[model samples]
Target: MEFSVMLELLFSGLLFTLEIFVVTLVGALPLGVPVALARMSKHKWLAWIARIYISVMRGTPLMLQLMAIMFGPYYLFHLNMGPDWKYWACGIGFIINYAAYFAEIYRSGLQSIARGQHEAAEVLGYTRAQAFTRIVLPQVVKRVLPAIGNEVITLVKDTSLAFVLGIMEMFSQAKALAASQVSMVPYAIAALIYWVFNFIVEMALTRVEKQLAYYHD
Candidate 1:
């Protein structure tokens, strides 16, 4: 393959990774916070439900989830799922699966906020909700950014799993190209794409982390 052709194929592969990563984060961020709260709830039933969700998502291999989401509709109901539906199913599955993990990370960060802080808020006559919104959440965000950044980077890598569902993501594109080229050049090019994209993401998240560090309590 020509150098230009290799670059084109590599770019397409990376784009798929980008799509999955962006969609996953969009779904996970707000959803993960709620999940974290649910898992931390004083209500036993609520906590149990949250724990079960997290357990199932974390316990099962993500690929299995993908297989189910991709095929479950037609098999169960004979619904003629469209291409958009497939992406949505995969997106939902990825978001739910990763959100469980992100929730745990957020919960740990929330725990790192001192017990006295909540006590102090209560002493000040702040409602629990007020205390959480006004004080605890900001601190948790600062504490968890590094870990969250780690997950975001990992998500960039995990996008390859989309290929299992026949999504023409970057790795899938590369595999197709590799077969046509009858060589590993396509795979090598794909690796370079991942490296470059992640390096850029790492740098950007590092800057954001530094900017938010001043808020660390």
Candidate 2:
């Protein structure tokens, strides 16, 4: 194919790559909070369940996880998801995998918080919920921003893993074009695209970190 046409195909695939990144963050970032809370819960069962989940997610290969999710329904329930299942499986697998990592990051930030802050908030007539939402959450977010940014950057490249499920994300697009054209240019372009995407993410994250810098623990 012509260079222009190749670029168009790659960009087309980049759109889905971007979608996976956004959807994963949307589903994982907030979902992580509850998992982190559960991990730290006083209730042993909840903590154990969360702990085990985190352990399993972190310990396994994400590609394997994606495969399991993609094929799980057919194997476990004898139900076929048909051709449309790849998109759902891709989103869910990425979300759950990243949620585990984010949960650990959140747990670290939450643990870093001093217990005295909670007591002080209570003394100031703040309910537990108010205290967390008002004071604790902000500090935790600021503290965790760098870690989250790292994960966000990693997710940019991880979107390529969607190919394991036969999703035509950017990398897969480049791979296909390169194979057909017998040229490395497509792969080179894909690298540039990924780097640019990550650069934008880094810039945005740095801006947020600077904004959060107004307060320090």
Candidate 3:
């Protein structure tokens, strides 16, 4: 009975974890790419702002972000919200935080392409955007997939941080079950859930990287 209860609690928490992971990626990946471009932009102000956002997010603890995002409206503006708002707030916080890191990852990969490739694209009568999307973007995706895979895995674990915001995410559920049952198994079970999920992510990323292994310059 204890084991079954623990499993149920953990499964419930998994939903919240998955919610955070999905929503954050949905919000962040596209945004991160743009932020990367902005950080690498010719304009000083754009780059500066991007750099500062990245610094603040990367410098601060994620725990702090979780706390501030969850409580900021209530404490600062005295506004209360509904259930969906909790996820939205937490998802936005995680997305903004992770997007900065992803943006830097994107910057490095985008810059890794040989300058000659751009020149060749010009020689072939391709416009800058066309060359970037058709010729350069493929290689950039290949190069960044591995790093992005790592971040995705990290994001899986980071989802547990949502519990700090009173989200009843997997970690929170597991912790509650553990305390109530007075058993170590609930925590161990939660760990297994995370490990298995991460294993699946790693495998999927491995397949993606392999499929793009042509190494074209």
Candidate 4:
């Protein structure tokens, strides 16, 4: 392929990669809140279940998780997945894996909060839900933004793991092209794209951090 043709092909794959990244974040971030709350629940059973879940998700390699999600259904239950299951499995795998990490970050932030804050909210006649939404949640978000940013940066690179499902994400596209053309140029281009992607993410997160800086209590 000509250089321009190669770049265009890779760009097309980058779009698929972006879709995975966005879907994972959109699903995982809010999903993590509940997981974090469950992990910290006063009910022992609920906490134990949540703890085991987080442990398993964090302990396993994400590539293996993707493979399991993609094939386990058919292998274990004899239920056939359609062709589109590739995208579905990738999204689920990424969301669940990232949610585990985000949940821990959230747990740390929630625990770092002072007990006095919750008590004060209650004394002020705020309901538990109201206090959490209005007062506690804001502080937790501010505290956890940097940690979340780190995970998000890692997620950008991890998106390449989608290739295991035969999804032609950026890395997969580059690999195929490099093999056919017998040139390392495609891989070099892919690396440049990835670096640019991470740089943009870092800049965006830095801006968000600055915006939340005023919330220091």
Candidate 5:
């Protein structure tokens, strides 16, 4: 294939890879906050349930989760594994898996805040909800920014795992093209693409961190 044609195919596949990263972040980050809160809840059962979930998600390999999500429905319920199920399963698996990681990050951030902060909020007549949403959450976000950035970068590379389910992400596409053309050029291009994507994520997160720098503790 011509270089331009090869580039086009790689770019097309890159879009799907980017979709997985973007959707996973968008879905995981918000959902993770509540999961984190539940993990720290006063109620024993709620905290226990959240802890077990986080443990399971963190303990197992993400590829295993993806495979289970992709195949479990058909195996357990005898549902059809249609053509589009791969993307759906991949999206759901990525979101939940990353959410567990994010939840732990969030829990650490939340716990790092001094107990006095919550007491101060209460003394000022703020409800628990108001205290968390207005005061605690902002600081937690600032503190967790670096950790979140690291996970986000990892997610960029992890998008390649979608290939196990037959999804044509960039790495998979590159492998296919390289095999067909008997050239290493496709893999090289894919590497460059992944590097550029991760570079952008790091730069963006650094900018956000700087913006929050003025926020002390």
Candidate 6:
């Protein structure tokens, strides 16, 4: 392939990779909060359900989860596995897996807040919702920003795993190009692309962390 053609193919793959990363983050981050809350709920059944979900998701390999999501519906429920199910399965798998990880990070941040803050909020006539949303969640975000940044960076790289389900992400495109050309240059370019992506993520998250630093003393 010509150099320009190779670059175009890689760029196309990168777009798909970014699509997966963005969708996963959008779906997982907010979904994680509720899962975290359920895990910490006073209700034993809710907490137990959340615990089991987190454990199963965390314990299994994401690649396996992706495969399961792609195939499980057909095998378990006798449903059709259509052509477009690849991206849907990939997106759902990434969302659920990352949500489990984020849930734990959220739980840790929530637990780190001093009980006195909750008490103070209540004493000031704040309802539980107001106290949590207004007083508690902001601090949790500040404390958990670094942890979330780490996960966000990981998700960028994990986008390559979409190839396991035959989605042609950047890394997969590079691999195919390298195989066809019998050169490692494509792989090297892919590595550079991944590094640049993570670098951008780190820089953006650093700015977010700084913005939240006002919450500190």
Q: Give lDDT per model, in order.
A: 0.88, 0.96, 0.90, 0.95, 0.95, 0.95
What lDDT would candidate 6 get against the real structure? 0.95
Q: Arrange candidates by TM-score, highest first: which order?
A: 2, 6, 4, 5, 3, 1
Better of 3 and 5 by lDDT: 5
lDDT for each residue of candidate 1 in 1-217, tens digit (9 for 90 to 100): 6879777767776777787888898998879989999999999999999999999999998889998988899999999898788788779889999999999999999989999999999999999999999899888888988899888888888889998888888888889988998989888878877888889999999898788777858
Root-mean-square deviation per candidate? 1.9, 0.9, 1.4, 1.2, 1.3, 1.2
lDDT of 5 by residue, 1-217 (tens): 8999999999999999989999999999999989999999999999999999999999999999999999999999999979999999999999999999999999999899999999999999999999999998789889999999999999999999999999998999999999999999999999999999999999999999998887787
TM-score per candidate:
0.91, 0.97, 0.95, 0.96, 0.95, 0.96
TM-score-better candidate, 2 vs 5: 2
Q: What digit string (tens of lDDT, one per residue) describes model 6 on residues 114-159?
A: 9999999999999999999988988999999999999999999899
Model 3 agreement with the true structure over 75-116: per-residue lDDT tens digits: 999988766777777988999999998999999998999999
Model 6 scores a TM of 0.96
Predicted structure 1: lDDT:
0.88
Error of 2 at 57 (Å): 0.5
Candidate 1 ranges with C-alpha deviation above 4 Å: 122-130
Report how far residue 51 has shifted in candidate 2, in Å: 0.6
Error of 6 at 136 (Å): 1.4
What ranking of all candidate models by lDDT puts the best one first?
Answer: 2, 5, 4, 6, 3, 1
Alpha-carbon shift of residue 18 in model 2 (angstroms): 0.7
Top TM-score model: 2
C-alpha lDDT (0 to 100) for residue 139 of candidate 2 = 98
Best by the lDDT measure: 2
lDDT of prediction 4: 0.95
Cα error, residue 40 of model 2, in Å, equals: 0.5
Candidate 4 per-residue lDDT, tens place, 67-169, comes to: 9999999999999999999999999999999999999999999999999999999999999999999999888889999899999999999999999999999
Q: What are the runs in model 2 whose C-alpha is more than 4 Å off?
A: none
Query: After superposition, which runs of candidate 3 have C-alpha atoms over 4 Å from their true positions?
Result: 82-84
lDDT of 3 at 48: 97
Q: Which is the winner by TM-score between candidate 1 and candidate 2?
A: 2
lDDT of 4 at 64: 99
